[model samples]
Target: MREIVIGGAQMGPIQKADTREEVVDRMIALLQQAKGAGCDLVVFPELCLTTFFPRWYMEDQAEVDQWFEREMPNAATAPLFAAAREAQIAISFGYAELTPEGRHFNTSILTDRDGNIVGKYRKTHLPGHSEFDHDRAFQHLEKRYFEPGDTGFQVWRNMDAIMGMCICNDRRWPETYRVMGLQGVELVMLGYNTPSVNSQDSVEGLEKRLYHSELSMTSAAYQNATWVVGVAKAGDEDGHPLMGGSMIVDPNGYVMARAETEGDELIVHACDMDACSFGKSTIFDFARHRRIEHYGLICSQTGVVLPD
Candidate 1:
């Protein structure tokens, strides 16, 4: 069995006026912390470089474009890549992307230990409405700002492990993990800018943000029998409060390390690859137990009714 060390970075607020350089510095500092802990890989939060800008209603395309990056390792972010190479650590980080092909996406990138761009995943399950509704306390206009992700859910082999990447809200969906698990995923990395304020129509659901967040990731971990590192960009970002629930969970559905506050912090854990074998061989063994052929009406049927 192989062993790897991972670091989860729970970052603080990103003020609306914060520059890209400032965020890079924070990321580099986290990288240094990971280095001190001898981490082979580190995970950063979704749209880690800027405020959760989508919360605002902006009509100008040019103004919106400012929040998205077109190039990786551009003048502003090169130092993060350089420092990672020097530290010999692979990293998975999320950012808002404005692609060369004229598409805007919420994307995540995987960089190998040698600092090479390995794989990129764009978020597919986009939540929130595009238009603003004043009836709700806040707007989660992710769907309005970001085009639905085209990459789909995917897993790639990197760092001697089958790794997967997804953005903030993607971790909440079970299929997000199952799609990659089919490819023999050993680890899943996610970054999120979750708001403590619940935007759901039901007022009662507001208090359940932390509960849903933890339950979502724990289910993903146990169902797939894989390690999951879900990082967050928390606290007040430009007056909007972001939820801070960064956690690292094992295959046994247990959280090994979790950050309780909204600040810059590091949680490192030594992960053994073989720890998931028992779960995989039993409950999650897809080849022997899965029934893919019967799922055709997955969307068409919501509940089963029995005659009284």
Candidate 2:
């Protein structure tokens, strides 16, 4: 079976004060490290190019524009792509994109070794409310700043493995991973910018953050018999703390690699594509095990209430 080394480029916080060039430079640095370690694909954090802006309430168009990337290989980020071409390495990075059509999306892009665009994933699960809540300690304004993504969850064949992509809150939903898993995905990649504090909900922010991270990835990987790489834009950003539990889980629901203490870090693992073959042949074999024909009754209206 073909094996590939993938890296999770865990970045700390990024501020509005940081320029596009500066942030891309940090990404390039991680790519260089991934290269030195003989890696083919490297994954970066969500909105790696800017601060977690949704934390504060902002109405100015120009101010919000500064936090977005208008072009993928534009001047500020050209160097990162150029370095990728030179190094002959592929990368998947997440950011806020402002399309020429004026649509804003939370996107993750896949690039080939020669810096050619492969595919893109717009976030599916848009969390929080568009309107402001006066009672919450902080705001999760993703639904306010961005529209729901049009592209559905997708899996692509790359580097001899069936791969898929997602971003941030998408990882928390089982349907998100199941959609891709149904496509026979061998690997799934995602990046997030989750906070350490919950603003609206009553759950303890730090604990839920970590729990969701591991639980979502492990369950997805094991249930689907695939590999999941979940990277984070962690640490304190603009005074809001982030949970730093970037991790890589295998087909057996075991964590293969994990972050130590946050900051700029990389976790590299030699993922054997063969292991997934054995897994798919057993518990996760869709052709034999998945009972899609009997799923409609899951939401069917029954006369009897559920027993206590």
Candidate 3:
């Protein structure tokens, strides 16, 4: 059996005053806890290093630059890698990436059991507006800070499974999973920081927000027949409360483990990669079930209009 024990390490709030070093130390603690629990992998949340900084509109470029990491194994983040290497636990976490060219992206990286970088993914479907929206309660200017991800959906073969990664708003997109699913991915790890309130439309309620998040993840897991671990950077960060329903779903779309509180928590499960074989080889098999002949409009059109 190709079994991988995964730990969904849901982080509590990262206060505005919190430093990257402090956050990394917290992550190391989670990794050590997961190691003690016999987890082969630990998945942390998006933007795990700092408070949700996008909520505020900033004018100082240097101040914003401070939030992005220039190097992966740089001084600030080295300890987490060292701990992972020592404990022999693979880890996936998200952070703001500052490329050498000075471009910024919402990014996540996966490390092998020995703490070697195995894969990286930049979030493609960036949510929020480029300019500040005065109508909303607060700002969500992800489009202003981060460039659209150049890297497409890609999968990696490591730690005895075909694994893929996505971040934050990317989790809400079906295309995100389908692209990796087509590549024979057996597991998908994702991180999110979903606010309970909809910045675009204030009329939306919290219950719907929570429901939608779970629905999107559960559907993706079952449809692709892949195990999904979605961890969240939850709790009230600088007065902005993010939803904290971090969970692990099996191939049958069943939630095997979930975090109960909006604090630092670990929800773990043993996922069998072979559970995906049946779905991929039979009912959901792309080669067998997908009929692309008449489905060109899906890609050809930008929108659909029905009769009035």
Candidate 4:
């Protein structure tokens, strides 16, 4: 039985005034807590280094690049890697990545116990508008600051488990998990910074958004027969309230642990790899029950035509 102790570290709001050193210290503090709890892995939320910068529309490229990290082990983040190495615990964290060619992507990196990078994933599903829209309560210009991830959904064998990653909106898409599920992923770690209010739909409230977050992750967990860890950067960020519903879901789609507050908190759970085998060998066994031949249209067509 490959049992892994997992820690979901949900962070509070990172105001614009917060410096990188301060944020890194907060992350290190969580790492220390996870270490104390005997956790084998810790997961932090997406774009954790700073306040959700996409909330503001910036015309200057230089101003936008300030939020992007040029290198992984730069001065500000070296402490995080050092702590993970010292504790011999694996870590998965998200950040804004600026490529050498000036391309920017919303990216996540997984590090082994020895502080070596195991794999990196760029966020494929980009949400929000690229241009400035005055109609919304706050601007969401992710489409303008970052490019759609070029890397397809990929899984890796790490920490004695088949792990996968996706960010934010990717959790809402079944295809994201299915692709990884097809590869025999046993656990998936993702991070999000979601606002409580929906700018696009006025009728949608915080309660509805929270419900959808839970529903999507739990459904994906059960359907894929994999454990899912979703960490959130919660609370109000620069006056915009973000939701704090970080949770860890088991293979049965049951939430094992969840954070109740919108702040820096850690929820640890021991996950048994054996739990996934039951579903994989039963109703969800793709090799035995799935009939791909009938679903060929999913790949053959981009859109479906409807009768008037």
Best by lDDT: 4
Assess the local accuracy of residue 21 in candidate 2 as a C-alpha lDDT between 0 and 100: 82
Report the lDDT tens digits of candidate 3 across residue range 54-154: 88798889999989999998898999999999999999999999999999999999999999999999999998888878888889989989999999999
Clashing pairs in 3: none
TM-scores for all predictions: 0.95, 0.94, 0.97, 0.98
- Per-residue C-alpha lDDT of model 4 across residues 144-206, encoded as one tens digit per residue: 999999888899999889999999999999989999999999999999999989988879998
Show the colliding residue pairs in model 4: none
Ranked by TM-score, the better of candidates 3 and 4 is 4
* Shift of residue 248 alpha carbon in model 4, Å: 0.3
The number of the candidate with the highest TM-score is: 4
Q: Tell me the tens digit of each residue's lDDT in model 1 across 207-228.
A: 5887899899998999999999
Model 2 over residues 114-151: C-alpha lDDT tens digits? 89888899998988877778988888889888878888
Enumerate residue pairs that collide in model 2.
none
Candidate 2 has a TM-score of: 0.94
The global C-alpha lDDT for each of the candidates, from Candidate 1 onward, is 0.89, 0.86, 0.92, 0.95
Stretches of candidate 4 off by over 4 Å are none
Error of 4 at 55 (Å): 0.5
Give the clash count for model 2: 0
